[model samples]
Target: MKILIVDDEVDILTLFKDVLESVGHEVDIAIDGESGLKKFRNKKYDVIVMDYRMHGKNGIDVAEEMLKMDRNTKIIFASADSSIKEKALEMGAVGFLLKPFDIDQIIKEVEKIEKN
Candidate 1:
């Protein structure tokens, strides 16, 4: 699957890109919500994994806009904050994986998407 990962931290972006690519998925990275939204509009991706606490726009806003553009757009939010899971789903995220999750969890989530 083609996946977009958005995070303010460069290391996290690289890590997710590397991990996802290793699993044979095309991966794209954005440093902020604006860039993420721009890329979202410009590309077709199977999934979007975004950070909830970004400096501008935030993941919720980004996902909300993406949903408006394509309601079927699948989104997964990655954050250390557990409290945002409910909000993330309300904003249209199909999954909420907390930061520091194992690669297996990511794979499982993607598998769940594939099932649907």
Candidate 2:
């Protein structure tokens, strides 16, 4: 699967990229929403893993925009704030991962989406 991961934290980006790539997925990383949106426009990804909080556009903002571009877009919102899960789901996110999540959890979510 081709996956795009948008997050401000370099560590998180690196970790996810490495893990996903190791599992045979093509992974792309963006440090902020603007860059992420730009990449999303330029390529077709099977899934997008986005951080809910960032300096520029937040995850919800990015997800909303991406969905407008492609209503079927699958977004997995990741954040330390569990409170936003409901809102993320309302906006059509396929999955929500609380920050400090296990890497296996992310893989499981992606696999679940892939199965569907």
Candidate 3:
């Protein structure tokens, strides 16, 4: 699946990109929500793995805009903050992964979305 990962942490970005690429998935990394949104506009991704807390635009804000443009967009929140899961889902996120989670969890989530 084509996946976009948006987060402020370089480590997180590199880790996700490495794992997703190793699994033969096309992966793109953005360090912030704005850039992630820009890439979303420029290309089509099967799923977006984003963090809820980010600089400038949060995941909710970005997802809201993305959903506006394409209501079918599949966004999964990979955030340390679990408090926003309900809100994220309500805002159209397909899944939520609380941080410090297993790397395989993300792959599974992406695959799950890919199947749908």
lDDT-best of 1 and 3? 3
Task: Give per-residue CA lDDT, model 1, range 85-116, as digits (tens).
Answer: 99998777999998888877887787788778
CA lDDT scores, all candidates in order: 0.89, 0.95, 0.93
Give all TM-scores, in the order shown: 0.94, 0.98, 0.97
Candidate 2: lDDT of 39? 100
- Best-matching candidate per lDDT: 2
lDDT of 3 by residue, 1-116 (tens): 88999999999999999999999999999999999999999999999998988899999999999999999999999999999999999989999999999999998998898788
lDDT of 2 at 68: 99
Give model 3's TM-score versus the native structure.
0.97
Candidate 2: tens digits of C-alpha lDDT, residues 27-64: 99999999999999999999999998998899999999
> TM-score winner among the candidates?
2
After superposition, the stretches of candidate 3 with alpha carbons farther than 4 Å from their true spots are none
lDDT accuracy of residue 91 in candidate 1: 71
- Candidate 3 lDDT at 113 equals 86
Clashing pairs in 1: none
- Is candidate 1 or 2 superior in TM-score? 2
